[model samples]
Structures are given as C-alpha cells and as structure tokens.
Target: MSDAVKRLAIRDRIAVLDVLRGLAILLILLMNIPAMGNLESARIDVTGWTAADQMATWLQRVIFAGTQRGMLELLFGAGMLIMASRAMQPDGPVAVADAYYRRNLWLVVFGLAHALLFMWWGEILFPYGLAALLIFQFRTLAPRTLMGIGLVVLLASGHWFGTQQYNARQQLLHDAPAALAIKAEGNPLSDDQSATVKRWEDLQASTKGTGKETQEERTGRTTTLAAFFKWNAKFWMGFTSDLLVLIIFEASATMLIGAALFKWGIIQGKRSARFYLALMLCAYAVAIPMRVIDTQQYMTLALDPRPGWITYQISRLAMTLGHLALVNLAISTGVGRWLLKPFEAAGRLPLSVYFGQSIICLWILFPPYGFGLWGKFGMAGMTAIAVGVIAFQVIVANLWLRWFENGPFEWLWKSLAYAKLQPFRKTPSAIHITAPI
Candidate 1:
C-alpha cells in the first residue's frame, strides 16, 4: 500500500461520524415507532386526529420522517468507504474484501432474524446488506465521480418509480367503481381488469383496514411462537415483493453519496465552517420549502401524491446533506464535544442498540404475549415511547462501554468477519500511561 493508504488506516475515529449515527438511530426509532407499535391512525392520514396528534404528525412529516433514514444510509456508505480504505493496506486487499463480504453476509442473517422474530416490517438491515454487496465494487472511485453517478441513479430511479406509482394509483381509482359495477351486475370481468381490481382491493385492505377489526388486533392475537413466525413470514414475503426496487434504489444511491462524502472529508468534520454554513443554508432553503409544499399537497388537496414523491428524492437528499453539514459545523465549532458523548457511545454499538430496540418493542408492544400495546398508542404516545427507548439505550451504551471494548453484537460480528475470536473486555494494560521518569 502507498503512504496514503497507510495514513488512512491509522486515522483516528471521527467523533462526528458516531454522533451522526447516534442521532440517526434515535430519529429512526421516532420515525418507526408508529409502525412498530401498529399505530395505523398515526400515519399521514389525518382522520379524526386530536390537536396533539395532529401536531405530532406534522412534526414527524416535517422533520423526522425520511431524513433520519437518509442520514443512516449516508453514514452506512461512509462506513463502507472507511473500512475499505483500511482494507487496502499492502497485501491486504483480498483479505479485506473477504471480511467485507463476510460482515455483510452476517448482516443479512441478522436482518432476517430481526424481521422474522421481532415482527418488525420496517427492517432496513437486509436491504442495506444487499446494497452494500453491490456498492463495494465502487469503493475506489473518486468522490466527484461517485457523487455524479449516485445523483443520476437517484434521480432516474425516483422519477421512474414515482411515475409508475402515480399511474397505478390513477388506474386503481378509475377501475374500482367500474369493477364494483360489473360485480353488482353479476358479470364476469376480464382477467386483466380483474387483476387491476384485485390490486386496488389489496391496497385498500392494507391501508384502510377490512372494518372487521383493526389490523393490529388481528395480527397481534398470535399467542404462540409458531403463529408469530407464520404471520411474519407471510408479511415479509409480501412486503419485500412490493417494495424491493424502492428499497434497493434508495439504499444504493444514498450509500454512494455517503461514500463520496467520506472521500471528500466533509463527513469527517474536515470542511471549513463557512463551507458547511453555506451548504446548510442552501440545502435547507431548497428542501424545507419543498417538504412543506409536498406535505400540504398530500394532506389537504388529496392529490395524486406522485409529484410529491418525485420531489421527495430531491428534498430528502438535500436535507440529508444539509444535516451532515450542520453536524460538521457543530463539531468543528466545539459545540459537539459535551453533547455528543452518549450519542457516540450508542453509535459505536449501533448493532446492539438496534437489536436491543427490537427486543424491547417486542416485549412491550407486541400483542397477546406482551403488553398488547400495538395500535394503542397515538402519535404523541409513540413519540414518548421512542424518547424513552433512546434515553435507555444511551445510558446502557455508556455503562456497557465503560468495561467492554465492543458491544456484544459488534464483537460477534467482528469475530465472524475476521474468522477469529476477538477480545471483548477492555484491558487495563491497553490504556496508555505517562512514564514515571
């Protein structure tokens, strides 16, 4: 390896990266709490909402919705590049490549377990692992080149996907009444028409419920382990089938952008304060307005929601970048150190924190066997739960790291990646001391 690679390998961990991860994890829980707890009414639909619930919904839409996940994806991409840089040491490329794939392979395994056992439909790990496998090939590209390619792919995919969804929604609405009329007349519909009608029905059923009972009640009634598996397996199969393209596109594109940012040193707090300030200003100036308009159009106008979807790509990307810039600025300006420790600890042990969250939610929120809290919480309640979960994780992470070198899951993952057992305990001798002389 060249001196550049060696220098990269020996560079200290960037605190801001961990802070970003910690913030992302916290925000992600907030964004996902409603879905995890099966709070269907807490979604964008504002039907029969209380003032507090409406406020919560608006806050989620304006700030926490897609942005957290976007930041997480960006960080994942940056982490990939950082790992790859270390792996490119002299005589280590092949070994590093092996470990990279191994790590991601295990991530896929963990993600599968998370989805099936935890009953969480919003599992991102599997999609992230799959995207990583494909993204690894571009690790050596220049920052500008990677960013260019990522932007093009992101825009293209967003436009194509949004147009398809728009057309589908329009077609579904157009066909529903006609199909119902045919059914009322006792006439056999054509197979194609029937298929469209079925799609419409499925959408309605999934989104609006069947009216027999809430989906949470039906799904949460599973008492046995076997029943839970059976239900989740079916759910996973359907969820992945419908959203696979969107998942892959979103993960891959944002990751590529992250990789580019890592190379540029922007994500490492190496950029000037003025540069970050400008980035923050410009990105938010564009993104916040677009987001507001998009939310308003969707909530009030009952529009097709496709234009918003397409613009979402632009707004989310800009806002995510802006968030990165703001974080960098904070760190560089010295405001980050005191406030960042808990987040850094949580971020360092992200895998543990992530799985820990699933466990907690399962025990507290999953039905019959647990608290049966699914669908019981409104937006405000869910937000409170999310805050509580984050606070608990932060405290636990700080305490755990005081004695351990890695989170339990992180140790296991690293051991598997390196094909050897890793030292989990923090050794006193490993701590540096000044010479008595």
Candidate 2:
C-alpha cells in the first residue's frame, strides 16, 4: 500500500461518533432482548404475563422499539461514508472498493453465521451489509439531495408496503366468507381462496401464538445445533422475501439520511446545542405520540390482522433522528459526558459488542445446553436480562479497549477486510484504527 492509503487506514478514530454508536448498541440490547430470549413473544404474544411484563412491553413499544435499530442504521451509513470516501480505483494493496466491499462481504458472512449458528433471526449484520453495498456510493452526494431523496424513498416504501399488506388482508377478508360458505356447503375451496385463508391464519399466528406452537418452537430450537440449524434455515427461507424488502428499501432509505447528516457534520458533534435541542424536541414530539397510536393499533391488530393505514416508517425516522439530536445535544452541551465516556470505548468495538450479544444470548443464555432460559420469560423478565447483558458488555468493552486496539472479532474482520495484518494492541503504533462498524 502507498503511504497515503496506509495513513488513511490509521486516521485517528472519532470519539463522539463512537460514543453515539456505543449508546445505540446499548439501547439496541434493551429493545432486542424480547426477541433474543423468546422468538414467539417477539411479536404481540403476551401469554402468561405479569403486571411488570405488561408495563415493560408497553414501555418498549412506546419509546425504545424501532428507534434503536434506526439509530444503528444511521450510524452504519456514516461509517460507510468514512470508509467508502477513500480512493475509488485499485491504486495499491488496499483499494477503496476492495477493502470496503471486502469488509461488507465479510459482514454478510458474519450475519449469515450469526443467524444460522446463533439462532437469532433478527440480526441486522446481514441486511446492513447488503444495504451497505448499495448505499456506499451515496457518500459523495450533496447533503440536501441525499436527505430529499431519502425522505421520498422512505415515505414511498411505507406507502407501497403498507398498501400491499392491506390489499392482502382485504383479499382474505373477501375470500374467507366465500371459502367458508363453500366448504360448509360440501364444496372444496378454490386455490386463491385456500391461499387467502392461509395468509389470514399466518397473520393471526404472527401476532399471538398458541402455547402449543410456542412449545414446539422452543423444543426445536433448544434440542441440538444440527436440528436448530435445519429448522432455522427453513424458517429463514420463509421470511426471506420480507427481509429483502427491508434490505432493499427501508434500511437503504434510513442509511441515506444518515449519510446526509454525516455529510453535514452533524453526526460528528459539530452541530450547536440549540440546533440539536430543537431537533430532539421536534422529532420526539412527533414520534412518541405516533408510536403510542401505533402500539394501540397493533394491540387491535390481533383481532384485525390486516395492515391498516399507518405511519410505521415516518414514526421510526422521527424517533431515530430524535435520538440522534438528543445525544449530540447532550455532548455539545457537555451535560452527560461522564456517562457517555465509557460508551466511547464500547462504541469502538461495536462489531465485537454486537456479535457478542448473540453469543451471550443465543449461544449461552437461552440455549438448553447453557441456561436453557429460552421461552421461559415474558417481556419484563427478558428485558431485565437484557439490561444485565448490556452492563456486562459495557464493562468488558472498556477493559478490553484498555489493553487492545480492537475487540477479537473486530481484529478478525479488519484483518480480512484490509487483507493485511492489522495492529491489535494499544501500544504506540504506526497505524490507526478503522471506523466503528
């Protein structure tokens, strides 16, 4: 590699951005535990719950639900910009495209392994990697253009997906009565009718699961790795279509906005306190209430499983941007650096911390071989565990950063991405660290 490429490789890591990413990871843990611990209860299944469970579920849906994922999407876009902004042509040992594409391809590999091996289908690495490949070129776009195009894409996606879902439910609503009537009259249902009825039933299963289905899932997941792998693979195939939608449009839209923000220098804590304060207030004012209404709609959705007119994407963008503004405001105002300091270290190792979460929950905490805690807790209990896991990661991340330049998984990823041996210690070195994941 040339001296320029080498120097670019070791540019000093940004602190405030790392802090923001670290905080996003911690909040993601809070939002993710319900799904990580019990797949059945990841939706609206509140079976065998307590008052605490109800309250926890309410709190998560109202405030912390989609925002965490949104924040990560924003950060991912910014990080991709920093990486992809370098030399575009194959100039040296590490061309920008080679390193960047290689890095994200490894992320795809990691994501697939995380889901199939760790049994966490909700993992974002795979999709984030996919979105990264598509959005990296937007790094050079003007901030306003990126934001404008992103907003259009986001709203359009919400409208299209929501309408499609609504139409499917409408079809089922039309077909069900006719199908039942025909069956009752001793005639078989048509193919479209049968498909509509099945879709209707799947919608029911999505919101609330029967105890029998939950038990069967838990048994399949916890019995053995080979069995769980086969089951997980099959299950993933069932939802690959929705996953593709999320990858191609929804995540890409949010990421575009993130790149715009980064282009404007807002994500680097360069914005004024007043500016961020106003942003946070306005975003939250719009989003929190929207989420409350969305929650109520979901509650009723169990009975009416059709997708209705909703602000799913709008609320998510508002809330996620609200969090971005809030964090930058706190940093710019210097009001909470003490609390945010440890997160700096935590953020630097986002790759390790993120994948580590799956290892902790899926590999050790929830599996039958470890604690066998899968499907044992409701939302409240699972959330409590998530909190503990977050604490553990934060403490360990700080300590790990003291002696090492990167977490273990980070070391591996960097090595593979750059196609070179990356320095891994905190000692004085000729190289700098890669940006946060």
> What are the Cα lDDT values of the candidates?
0.74, 0.75
lDDT of candidate 1 over 319-376, digit per residue (tens): 8888888877776654565666568878778889888887888656656577866656
Return the lDDT, model 1, position 168: 76
The window of 10 residues in a row where model 2 has the poorest summed lDDT is 2-11
- 1-437, model 2: which lDDT tens digit per residue? 54434423334677777888898888798777776677653356444467787778778887887787788888887887776655433342346666677888999898888777777777788888898788866766788999998899988988777777677667677777777777779888788877766665665665667544455566667798776667667666666655576456878888898889998988777778888899899999988887887677765544453333446788888988888888777765544766577788778788898888988987788877778887788888888998898888899998886678778888888787777877788777634354432
Task: Please provide TM-scores, in order, for all candidate models, with all chains considered together.
Answer: 0.88, 0.90
Model 1 off-target regions past 4 Å?
Answer: 1-11, 39-48, 86-92, 182-188, 201-207, 211-217, 220-223, 301-303, 429-437
Clash counts for the predictions, in order: 0, 1
Q: What is the lDDT of residue 68 in candidate 1?
A: 84
Candidate 2 is scored at a TM of 0.90
Model 1: how far residue 276 lies from native, Å: 1.1
